[model samples]
Target: MRWIAILPVLALAACAAPEAPGSERVPAARAIERPFDVSTNVDFILVDKSDRTLTLFRKGTPVRAYRGVAFGDAPTGHKRFQGDERTPEGRYRIEYGNPQSAFHLSLKISYPNAEDRAYAAKHGLSPGGDIFIHGQPNGSPEGQKIASHWTDGCIALSDAEIEELWQTVPDGTPIEIRP
Candidate 1:
Protein backbone atom coordinates (compact mmCIF):
# COMPACT_ATOMS: atom_id res chain seq x y z
CA MET A 1 0.00 0.00 0.00
CA ARG A 2 2.60 2.53 1.08
CA TRP A 3 4.84 1.39 -1.77
CA ILE A 4 2.36 2.66 -4.34
CA ALA A 5 2.66 6.21 -3.09
CA ILE A 6 6.44 5.99 -3.19
CA LEU A 7 6.45 5.11 -6.87
CA PRO A 8 4.76 8.34 -7.95
CA VAL A 9 7.03 10.36 -5.70
CA LEU A 10 10.07 8.81 -7.29
CA ALA A 11 8.71 9.44 -10.75
CA LEU A 12 8.01 13.07 -9.94
CA ALA A 13 11.48 13.57 -8.49
CA ALA A 14 13.12 12.08 -11.55
CA CYS A 15 11.20 14.40 -13.82
CA ALA A 16 11.75 17.51 -11.72
CA ALA A 17 15.50 17.10 -11.37
CA PRO A 18 16.31 18.06 -14.97
CA GLU A 19 14.34 21.32 -14.91
CA ALA A 20 16.20 23.01 -12.06
CA PRO A 21 18.16 25.47 -14.18
CA GLY A 22 15.52 26.20 -16.81
CA SER A 23 14.00 29.25 -15.01
CA GLU A 24 12.80 28.73 -11.46
CA ARG A 25 16.39 28.51 -10.24
CA VAL A 26 16.96 32.23 -10.65
CA PRO A 27 14.20 34.67 -9.82
CA ALA A 28 15.19 37.70 -11.89
CA ALA A 29 17.07 36.02 -14.71
CA ARG A 30 13.99 34.27 -16.11
CA ALA A 31 11.78 37.33 -16.24
CA ILE A 32 9.74 37.64 -19.47
CA GLU A 33 10.95 39.99 -22.21
CA ARG A 34 8.42 42.11 -24.07
CA PRO A 35 9.14 43.09 -27.67
CA PHE A 36 8.55 46.80 -27.22
CA ASP A 37 11.03 48.76 -25.20
CA VAL A 38 8.98 51.90 -25.23
CA SER A 39 10.76 55.24 -25.61
CA THR A 40 9.44 55.98 -22.17
CA ASN A 41 10.04 53.74 -19.15
CA VAL A 42 6.75 51.94 -18.62
CA ASP A 43 5.53 52.35 -15.08
CA PHE A 44 2.18 50.64 -14.74
CA ILE A 45 -0.18 48.09 -16.31
CA LEU A 46 -3.83 48.47 -17.32
CA VAL A 47 -6.54 45.81 -17.50
CA ASP A 48 -9.95 46.68 -18.89
CA LYS A 49 -11.96 44.11 -17.01
CA SER A 50 -15.21 44.72 -18.79
CA ASP A 51 -13.63 44.40 -22.19
CA ARG A 52 -11.32 41.57 -21.20
CA THR A 53 -8.35 43.68 -22.13
CA LEU A 54 -4.79 44.07 -20.86
CA THR A 55 -2.36 46.83 -21.65
CA LEU A 56 1.24 47.64 -20.93
CA PHE A 57 2.34 51.22 -20.46
CA ARG A 58 5.59 53.07 -20.18
CA LYS A 59 5.78 56.35 -18.35
CA GLY A 60 2.02 56.73 -18.48
CA THR A 61 1.93 55.98 -22.18
CA PRO A 62 0.34 53.04 -23.91
CA VAL A 63 3.10 51.07 -25.51
CA ARG A 64 0.88 48.14 -26.46
CA ALA A 65 -2.54 46.73 -25.72
CA TYR A 66 -4.31 43.44 -26.44
CA ARG A 67 -8.00 43.09 -27.15
CA GLY A 68 -8.37 39.58 -25.79
CA VAL A 69 -11.33 37.23 -25.62
CA ALA A 70 -11.78 35.92 -22.12
CA PHE A 71 -13.41 32.91 -20.53
CA GLY A 72 -16.71 31.83 -22.06
CA ASP A 73 -19.67 30.85 -19.86
CA ALA A 74 -20.39 33.12 -16.89
CA PRO A 75 -16.82 34.21 -16.39
CA THR A 76 -16.57 35.44 -12.83
CA GLY A 77 -14.05 36.80 -10.34
CA HIS A 78 -10.97 34.69 -9.56
CA LYS A 79 -10.63 31.19 -10.89
CA ARG A 80 -11.37 28.51 -8.29
CA PHE A 81 -12.03 25.06 -9.70
CA GLN A 82 -10.37 23.19 -12.53
CA GLY A 83 -12.92 24.27 -15.16
CA ASP A 84 -14.45 27.40 -13.72
CA GLU A 85 -14.10 29.23 -17.03
CA ARG A 86 -13.09 32.37 -15.16
CA THR A 87 -10.00 34.39 -15.75
CA PRO A 88 -8.16 35.02 -12.54
CA GLU A 89 -8.14 38.54 -11.10
CA GLY A 90 -4.75 39.36 -9.67
CA ARG A 91 -1.22 40.55 -10.29
CA TYR A 92 0.82 38.28 -12.53
CA ARG A 93 3.59 38.32 -15.09
CA ILE A 94 4.17 36.90 -18.52
CA GLU A 95 6.45 33.91 -18.19
CA TYR A 96 6.90 32.68 -21.73
CA GLY A 97 5.44 32.23 -25.21
CA ASN A 98 4.39 29.21 -27.23
CA PRO A 99 5.14 29.33 -30.92
CA GLN A 100 3.67 25.86 -31.46
CA SER A 101 0.47 26.35 -29.57
CA ALA A 102 -2.88 25.10 -30.84
CA PHE A 103 -3.69 28.78 -31.04
CA HIS A 104 -1.94 30.70 -33.79
CA LEU A 105 0.19 32.34 -31.11
CA SER A 106 0.36 31.90 -27.37
CA LEU A 107 1.92 33.53 -24.31
CA LYS A 108 2.13 31.78 -20.97
CA ILE A 109 0.58 33.38 -17.91
CA SER A 110 1.76 32.82 -14.34
CA TYR A 111 -1.28 31.24 -12.78
CA PRO A 112 -1.61 29.07 -9.68
CA ASN A 113 0.60 31.36 -7.67
CA ALA A 114 1.16 30.61 -4.01
CA GLU A 115 -2.20 32.06 -3.14
CA ASP A 116 -3.95 30.12 -5.85
CA ARG A 117 -2.36 26.85 -4.87
CA ALA A 118 -3.13 27.47 -1.23
CA TYR A 119 -6.74 28.25 -2.00
CA ALA A 120 -7.12 25.10 -4.03
CA ALA A 121 -5.49 22.99 -1.39
CA LYS A 122 -7.79 24.37 1.27
CA HIS A 123 -10.81 23.76 -0.85
CA GLY A 124 -9.71 20.21 -1.67
CA LEU A 125 -9.62 20.84 -5.40
CA SER A 126 -7.39 22.09 -8.16
CA PRO A 127 -6.91 25.81 -8.90
CA GLY A 128 -6.83 24.85 -12.55
CA GLY A 129 -3.51 25.53 -14.17
CA ASP A 130 -2.19 26.03 -17.77
CA ILE A 131 -3.83 29.42 -18.22
CA PHE A 132 -2.27 31.56 -20.94
CA ILE A 133 -2.68 34.52 -23.28
CA HIS A 134 -2.74 33.23 -26.78
CA GLY A 135 -4.12 33.57 -30.28
CA GLN A 136 -7.02 31.70 -31.81
CA PRO A 137 -6.77 28.01 -32.53
CA ASN A 138 -5.59 26.83 -35.96
CA GLY A 139 -9.05 26.55 -37.50
CA SER A 140 -11.02 28.60 -35.04
CA PRO A 141 -9.84 32.11 -35.78
CA GLU A 142 -13.09 33.01 -37.48
CA GLY A 143 -15.16 31.43 -34.76
CA GLN A 144 -13.20 33.32 -32.13
CA LYS A 145 -13.68 36.62 -33.92
CA ILE A 146 -17.39 36.06 -33.94
CA ALA A 147 -17.69 35.05 -30.30
CA SER A 148 -16.49 36.10 -26.85
CA HIS A 149 -15.47 33.97 -23.90
CA TRP A 150 -13.60 31.06 -25.42
CA THR A 151 -10.42 29.92 -23.72
CA ASP A 152 -10.31 27.88 -20.53
CA GLY A 153 -8.85 30.76 -18.50
CA CYS A 154 -6.33 32.57 -20.62
CA ILE A 155 -6.51 35.88 -22.45
CA ALA A 156 -6.79 35.59 -26.22
CA LEU A 157 -6.13 38.07 -29.01
CA SER A 158 -6.83 38.37 -32.66
CA ASP A 159 -4.21 37.14 -35.09
CA ALA A 160 -3.05 40.65 -35.90
CA GLU A 161 -3.18 41.71 -32.28
CA ILE A 162 -1.14 38.72 -31.19
CA GLU A 163 1.45 39.48 -33.79
CA GLU A 164 1.73 43.01 -32.48
CA LEU A 165 1.83 41.69 -28.94
CA TRP A 166 4.47 39.15 -29.88
CA GLN A 167 6.72 41.93 -31.05
CA THR A 168 5.89 44.48 -28.36
CA VAL A 169 5.47 42.51 -25.18
CA PRO A 170 8.55 40.96 -23.62
CA ASP A 171 8.62 37.84 -21.48
CA GLY A 172 9.19 39.55 -18.14
CA THR A 173 6.63 42.29 -18.43
CA PRO A 174 4.25 42.64 -15.48
CA ILE A 175 0.52 42.15 -16.00
CA GLU A 176 -2.45 42.96 -13.84
CA ILE A 177 -5.95 41.53 -14.34
CA ARG A 178 -9.02 42.98 -12.72
CA PRO A 179 -12.74 42.24 -12.63
Candidate 2:
Protein backbone atom coordinates (compact mmCIF):
# COMPACT_ATOMS: atom_id res chain seq x y z
CA MET A 1 0.00 0.00 0.00
CA ARG A 2 2.85 2.46 0.86
CA TRP A 3 4.65 1.71 -2.37
CA ILE A 4 1.56 2.53 -4.41
CA ALA A 5 1.13 5.86 -2.54
CA ILE A 6 4.79 6.88 -3.11
CA LEU A 7 4.60 6.19 -6.84
CA PRO A 8 2.31 9.15 -7.57
CA VAL A 9 4.64 11.59 -5.78
CA LEU A 10 7.61 10.31 -7.76
CA ALA A 11 5.67 10.68 -10.97
CA LEU A 12 4.73 14.27 -10.14
CA ALA A 13 8.33 15.15 -9.39
CA ALA A 14 9.50 13.66 -12.64
CA CYS A 15 7.05 15.78 -14.58
CA ALA A 16 8.44 19.01 -13.18
CA ALA A 17 10.63 21.08 -15.46
CA PRO A 18 14.33 20.70 -15.20
CA GLU A 19 16.59 23.64 -14.42
CA ALA A 20 19.09 25.07 -16.88
CA PRO A 21 22.74 24.42 -16.16
CA GLY A 22 25.74 26.77 -15.44
CA SER A 23 23.83 29.39 -13.50
CA GLU A 24 21.07 29.78 -10.96
CA ARG A 25 19.26 32.41 -13.01
CA VAL A 26 17.92 31.37 -16.40
CA PRO A 27 16.99 33.53 -19.36
CA ALA A 28 13.41 33.76 -20.43
CA ALA A 29 14.35 33.38 -24.08
CA ARG A 30 15.78 30.44 -25.92
CA ALA A 31 19.38 31.34 -26.66
CA ILE A 32 20.96 28.29 -28.23
CA GLU A 33 19.80 27.54 -31.73
CA ARG A 34 22.20 24.60 -32.15
CA PRO A 35 24.73 22.78 -30.09
CA PHE A 36 28.45 23.12 -30.71
CA ASP A 37 30.64 20.27 -31.97
CA VAL A 38 33.36 19.61 -29.45
CA SER A 39 35.43 17.54 -31.86
CA THR A 40 36.44 20.62 -33.83
CA ASN A 41 39.78 22.01 -32.76
CA VAL A 42 39.91 25.77 -32.37
CA ASP A 43 43.45 27.10 -32.27
CA PHE A 44 43.01 30.75 -33.05
CA ILE A 45 40.49 33.52 -32.58
CA LEU A 46 40.11 36.84 -34.34
CA VAL A 47 38.06 39.83 -33.34
CA ASP A 48 37.35 42.68 -35.74
CA LYS A 49 36.32 45.73 -33.80
CA SER A 50 35.07 47.63 -36.81
CA ASP A 51 32.90 44.79 -38.03
CA ARG A 52 31.99 43.55 -34.58
CA THR A 53 32.69 39.92 -35.32
CA LEU A 54 34.49 37.12 -33.56
CA THR A 55 35.81 34.25 -35.65
CA LEU A 56 37.36 30.98 -34.60
CA PHE A 57 40.09 29.41 -36.71
CA ARG A 58 41.30 25.84 -36.90
CA LYS A 59 44.91 25.54 -37.94
CA GLY A 60 44.75 28.89 -39.76
CA THR A 61 41.42 28.21 -41.47
CA PRO A 62 38.23 29.83 -40.31
CA VAL A 63 35.91 27.37 -38.66
CA ARG A 64 33.23 29.33 -36.84
CA ALA A 65 32.15 32.93 -36.73
CA TYR A 66 29.81 34.94 -34.49
CA ARG A 67 28.38 38.14 -35.86
CA GLY A 68 26.92 41.24 -34.20
CA VAL A 69 29.34 40.94 -31.34
CA ALA A 70 29.36 43.74 -28.77
CA PHE A 71 32.27 45.65 -27.33
CA GLY A 72 33.17 48.47 -24.96
CA ASP A 73 31.11 51.61 -24.73
CA ALA A 74 33.77 53.63 -26.50
CA PRO A 75 34.57 50.83 -28.99
CA THR A 76 37.27 52.83 -30.79
CA GLY A 77 41.05 52.62 -30.67
CA HIS A 78 43.17 50.28 -28.56
CA LYS A 79 42.42 50.15 -24.85
CA ARG A 80 45.23 51.96 -23.05
CA PHE A 81 44.10 52.46 -19.47
CA GLN A 82 41.56 51.25 -17.01
CA GLY A 83 38.04 52.64 -17.57
CA ASP A 84 38.89 53.62 -21.15
CA GLU A 85 35.83 51.70 -22.40
CA ARG A 86 37.79 50.51 -25.43
CA THR A 87 38.68 47.00 -26.39
CA PRO A 88 42.34 46.18 -26.71
CA GLU A 89 43.88 45.62 -30.11
CA GLY A 90 46.75 43.27 -30.96
CA ARG A 91 47.66 39.70 -30.02
CA TYR A 92 46.59 38.02 -26.80
CA ARG A 93 45.61 34.60 -25.49
CA ILE A 94 42.57 32.97 -23.90
CA GLU A 95 43.79 32.52 -20.37
CA TYR A 96 40.94 30.67 -18.70
CA GLY A 97 37.21 30.03 -18.32
CA ASN A 98 34.68 31.38 -15.85
CA PRO A 99 31.57 29.31 -15.47
CA GLN A 100 30.33 31.19 -12.41
CA SER A 101 30.55 34.61 -13.97
CA ALA A 102 27.91 37.31 -13.65
CA PHE A 103 27.44 36.80 -17.35
CA HIS A 104 26.13 33.47 -18.60
CA LEU A 105 29.69 32.24 -19.20
CA SER A 106 33.08 33.81 -19.96
CA LEU A 107 36.57 33.23 -21.25
CA LYS A 108 39.25 35.46 -19.85
CA ILE A 109 41.48 37.29 -22.31
CA SER A 110 45.13 37.94 -21.59
CA TYR A 111 45.24 41.68 -22.02
CA PRO A 112 47.97 44.12 -21.03
CA ASN A 113 50.67 42.43 -23.02
CA ALA A 114 54.20 43.75 -22.88
CA GLU A 115 53.49 46.54 -25.31
CA ASP A 116 50.31 47.46 -23.51
CA ARG A 117 52.08 47.54 -20.19
CA ALA A 118 54.90 49.58 -21.60
CA TYR A 119 52.58 52.17 -23.02
CA ALA A 120 50.58 52.44 -19.82
CA ALA A 121 53.73 52.59 -17.74
CA LYS A 122 55.27 55.30 -19.87
CA HIS A 123 52.08 57.30 -19.66
CA GLY A 124 51.61 56.55 -15.94
CA LEU A 125 48.23 54.97 -16.48
CA SER A 126 46.91 51.61 -15.41
CA PRO A 127 46.34 49.19 -18.23
CA GLY A 128 43.00 47.67 -17.43
CA GLY A 129 42.84 43.95 -16.84
CA ASP A 130 40.15 41.25 -16.45
CA ILE A 131 39.17 41.54 -20.05
CA PHE A 132 37.02 38.66 -21.30
CA ILE A 133 34.66 37.32 -23.94
CA HIS A 134 31.36 36.85 -22.22
CA GLY A 135 27.64 36.46 -22.66
CA GLN A 136 24.69 38.62 -21.65
CA PRO A 137 24.16 39.71 -18.10
CA ASN A 138 22.79 36.98 -15.90
CA GLY A 139 19.03 36.90 -15.30
CA SER A 140 18.23 38.91 -18.40
CA PRO A 141 14.56 38.55 -19.26
CA GLU A 142 13.34 37.22 -22.54
CA GLY A 143 13.45 39.73 -25.40
CA GLN A 144 15.63 42.12 -23.46
CA LYS A 145 18.52 43.25 -25.61
CA ILE A 146 21.68 45.12 -24.77
CA ALA A 147 23.14 47.91 -26.84
CA SER A 148 25.61 47.20 -29.64
CA HIS A 149 28.54 48.38 -27.56
CA TRP A 150 27.82 48.16 -23.83
CA THR A 151 30.68 46.57 -21.98
CA ASP A 152 33.13 48.48 -19.85
CA GLY A 153 35.91 46.94 -21.92
CA CYS A 154 35.17 43.26 -22.43
CA ILE A 155 33.71 41.67 -25.55
CA ALA A 156 30.12 40.50 -25.40
CA LEU A 157 28.35 37.75 -27.32
CA SER A 158 25.02 36.08 -27.22
CA ASP A 159 24.50 33.59 -24.43
CA ALA A 160 24.31 30.76 -26.90
CA GLU A 161 27.41 31.87 -28.76
CA ILE A 162 29.41 32.16 -25.59
CA GLU A 163 28.23 28.74 -24.48
CA GLU A 164 29.47 27.33 -27.76
CA LEU A 165 32.77 29.12 -27.34
CA TRP A 166 33.07 28.01 -23.73
CA GLN A 167 32.98 24.45 -24.98
CA THR A 168 35.11 24.92 -28.10
CA VAL A 169 37.84 27.39 -27.10
CA PRO A 170 40.64 26.10 -24.91
CA ASP A 171 43.16 27.89 -22.78
CA GLY A 172 46.19 29.45 -24.49
CA THR A 173 44.40 29.96 -27.80
CA PRO A 174 45.88 32.92 -29.61
CA ILE A 175 43.59 35.87 -30.31
CA GLU A 176 44.14 38.86 -32.54
CA ILE A 177 41.97 41.95 -32.42
CA ARG A 178 41.91 44.33 -35.36
CA PRO A 179 40.69 47.88 -35.58
| Top candidate (lDDT) | 2
lDDT of model 1 at residue 134? Answer: 73
Q: What TM-score does candidate 2 reach?
A: 0.77
Error of 1 at 166 (Å): 1.0
Per-residue lDDT of 50-165 in model 2, one digit per residue for the tens? 77778776766566777788999999999999999999998899999999999989999999899999999999999989999999999997535585799989999988778879
Q: Model-by-model lDDT, in order?
A: 0.67, 0.83
User: Hey, what RMSD does candidate 1 come out at?
Assistant: 16.4
Best by TM-score: 2
Residue pairs clashing in model 2 are none
The digit string of per-residue lDDT tens for model 1 on 1-179 reads 99997999888888865532211221121223445653433444555557666666665455565554556455667887788887887777778778888887887778879999999999899998887777777887464563577677777777766766676667876777767
